[model samples]
Target: MLHVNSRTALLNNAAFSLDVPAKIENGTTYVPARVFAEAFGGTALWSEQERKATITIGLQQVFIHTEPHKHWRMSQERINVLNEKINEATDLSSYSQIRTHFRPYFTDSFINKIIYSNGIKNNAILTKKGRYYLQ
Candidate 1:
C-alpha cells in the first residue's frame, strides 16, 4: 500500500518527498511520473526523437508519450547521489554523506539483488570503466 500526503509519500515504510505535490482529481490521486517510478526501484529515460519517457525495472519496461507543450519537473537526485559516489570512490562505504539520506536506495530489495548477484563481489564492484567499488 502507498500513503501520500501533499508532496510526501510512503511505500513499504520508505518515505519520499517530491518537489511537486500529488494531485487529487475526482478523488483519485496522481503523482509525478518520475516520483512514482523511482519509488518502485525503476529508472526513467527520456527520448527526444520519440517524445517519450520510459521506465525500466528489472526485465520490465513502460513507455509514456510526452507532450512538448506540457511541463514536467523530474528530479534524479536520488540516483545522482549513488552514481556520484560510485564514480568517485572505490568503495560504497567511502561515501561521506549521511547514510540516512540514501536509506531508500540502499534498502531497496531490487538494488540489493543486483549488487549481490551481478555487480558486487567481496565487498567490491567493477564499474564499466574498470574502477573498483567497495561495499
Candidate 2:
C-alpha cells in the first residue's frame, strides 16, 4: 500500500466540484460562472465601471420601471365601519344563533336532557360532523 498526497486526490475526494458559477463575492469562494450560466441558459459579464470585481449577471434583460400612485389609502370612515362590523360579528356567541337556525335538527330526548341538565344555553353538541347548540 502507498500513501500519496495529491491535489487530484483532494479534488476527487471533495464533496463538490467548482464550475463557472452564478454568483461570486470578494473574500469568499469564487464559484465557476459558466456552469450556472449554461444550466440556466443565461450569461454572466464583468464590468469595468464596477471595477471588474463585481459580477454582473443576466445579459438578456427586461427592466420595467413603473411608479405607482401612493395616494390611494383606506379612509378613517371605512376603517371605522370595518372595525364596527368585525366587533358586531365577534361580540356574541355563535352557538345561540346556530341553535335558533337548526332547532328542528335536535331530537326531543336531547332537548329535554339539555333543558334539565345544567345551563347548557350556549353549550354545543357535535352532531354529524356539525355543531348544534342546546335551545
Candidate 3:
C-alpha cells in the first residue's frame, strides 16, 4: 500500500524506500511505476526514443505511453461538440434520442449497445452474452 506524499511503501508489512514520494494530482494518484513494478516482482523498461514504458511480469507484458494520444486534439474537439449538444438539449426526452444525435461520435460497440441493448443495465441475457463473447 502507498500513502500520498510519502516516499515509503509497505509490502507484506515490510517497508520499502523510494527516491520519489507518491503524489495525487487532479484527483489521480501518481506513483513511481518502476518502484511499484519492482516491488511486485516485475521489470519495467523505459524507451526514451518511443517515450514509453514496457513492463513485464512473468509471461505478460504491458506497454504504457508517456505522450498524449495522436488524436487527442480531435477527441477534445469532439467532446466539446458533444458537450455543447448536451447543454443545448432542452426537449430531449430519452437517452436513446441523445445517443442517436451523438451516434457519429460514438464507437461501433457503443453504437451496437444503443441499437441492440435496452439500456445500460446488465441483465442476465447481457451477462451471458458478454461471457460467451469473451470465451
Candidate 4:
C-alpha cells in the first residue's frame, strides 16, 4: 500500500523507497509519473511542453495530463463505470447486452483481450444491426 506524503511503498510486506515522495490530496494519492508508470510494465514519456505523460505498454498507450482537468476527469469517471459494468458481467449473453454501452470506452483489441483472457468464447454471432450474440 502507498500513502500520502510518504516516499515508501509496501508490497508483499516489504517496503520499497521511492525517489519522489507520494502525495495525497482529496483522497487521491499521487506518485511520481515515471515510477508509477514503470510499475505497470509501461514506459512513461513526460512532455514538458504539453504538461502530460504518455504511458506505453506493449501496443497499448494512454495519455495522462500532469494537472487535473474537468473534462478528462469526467472521461475517467465514465471509464471507471464502464469497467465496473464489464466486471459484473459473467457470461457472454450478459456481456453482449451492454456491447454498445461500453463501445465508446473500449477498443476492439481491449474487448477481445478481456473476453479471451476470462476464458470466454470468442465466437460471437453478429446481427444485421452489428450487435453480437453468443454462438
Candidate 5:
C-alpha cells in the first residue's frame, strides 16, 4: 500500500498506487516493469542479452536490476518531479530534507536493482526517510 501522508496529493498523482505481480523473497517485495517505465517514468530498461545492453535516457545510469527490499522499483532522478511536501509546511530542515532521502521512483530499472541486490545477491539496504510499504 503506497502510503503518502497526504491522501489529497495521492489523488492528484497518476501512479501512486500501482498494482503488479512480483515475487517475495527474504522479506522483500519485488515489482514488475510496467510499475517502472510506464508507471513512474523511470529511465529505459535494456538487457545485455538483447543487443549489448543499450538503454538510452536523459539521465545517466549504467543499468539497474531488482534488489529486493520494501522500496519501489525505480530511480527518483529519472522519474518526474514528485511534489513531496513532507516538509513543505514545516519550519524544520529535518522535515524539509525528507524528499532528499527517498529514491522514490517506481521504475523498472530501480526495481530490478533492488531485487537483484537484496533477494538475489542478499545485501542490506540502508533505510531512507520515506516509509517503505507494499501495494
Candidate 6:
C-alpha cells in the first residue's frame, strides 16, 4: 500500500522505498509500476519507443500506456483484437508454438523472458471457488 505523495510503500508488512512517490492526480492514485511489480515478485519493462510499460507476474501480464491522449484515443476494436490474439496464443502447449504465435504482439526479448522464467508451475490446483492455488 502507498500513502499519497509518499515515496515509501508497504508490501507484505515490509517497507520499501520508491524512486517516484505515489500521487493523486485528477482524483486518480498513481503508483510507480516498477516498484509495484517488484513488490509482487514480478518484473516491469519500459519501452522508450512505445512509451509503454509491461508488467509480468506469473502467467499474467499488464500493459500500461503512459501517453494520456493516446490511451483515450485507443479503439475498443483494437483492444479486442489484441486480447483475442493473446487468448489464442496462450492456449498453445509448446514454447516454440507460443513464441511463434506471440511474436507479432510482443517483443522477442519479452517472449524469451517469459519462456525461460522459472516462475511457471505445473502443480497448480483448482480450488472449489474456481480460483487456482499454486501448490
Q: Give TM-scores for every candidate, taking all chains together and pairing residue i with residue i.
A: 0.39, 0.25, 0.42, 0.37, 0.25, 0.43
Comparing 2 and 6 on TM-score, the stronger one: 6
Question: What would the per-residue lDDT of candidate 4 be over residues 74-106, giving only the tens digit for each residue?
Answer: 344454555455555335555544556546666
lDDT of 2 by residue, 1-135 (tens): 111221121223443333323233464543344333434556545444443332234555422233433455555555455334333333234446533432453455554444454324443322223232222
lDDT of 5 by residue, 1-135 (tens): 234222221322654544434566588766544344433444455564543333334464444554334546444432223323211212223443332343353355544443344322322333353443444
Clashing pairs in 4: none
Cα lDDT listed for each candidate: 0.61, 0.39, 0.66, 0.63, 0.39, 0.70
TM-score of candidate 5 against the unseen true structure? 0.25
Candidate RMSDs in order: 15.3, 21.7, 15.5, 15.8, 18.7, 17.4
* TM-score-sorted candidate list, best first: 6, 3, 1, 4, 2, 5
Best-fitting candidate, scored by TM-score: 6
lDDT digits (tens) for residues 16-89 of candidate 1: 67667777778899877777678778887879999998988878999999766654442455345566544433
Candidate 1: where are CA atoms >4 Å away?
1-5, 47-50, 70-135
Error of 2 at 15 (Å): 16
For candidate 1, give the lDDT. Answer: 0.61
Stretches of candidate 4 exceeding 4 Å from the true structure: 1-3, 10-19, 66-135
* Candidate with best lDDT: 6
Q: RMSD, model 4, all Cα superposed?
A: 15.8
lDDT of 2 at 5: 23
- Name model 5 segments beyond 4 Å from true: 1-20, 48-58, 65-135
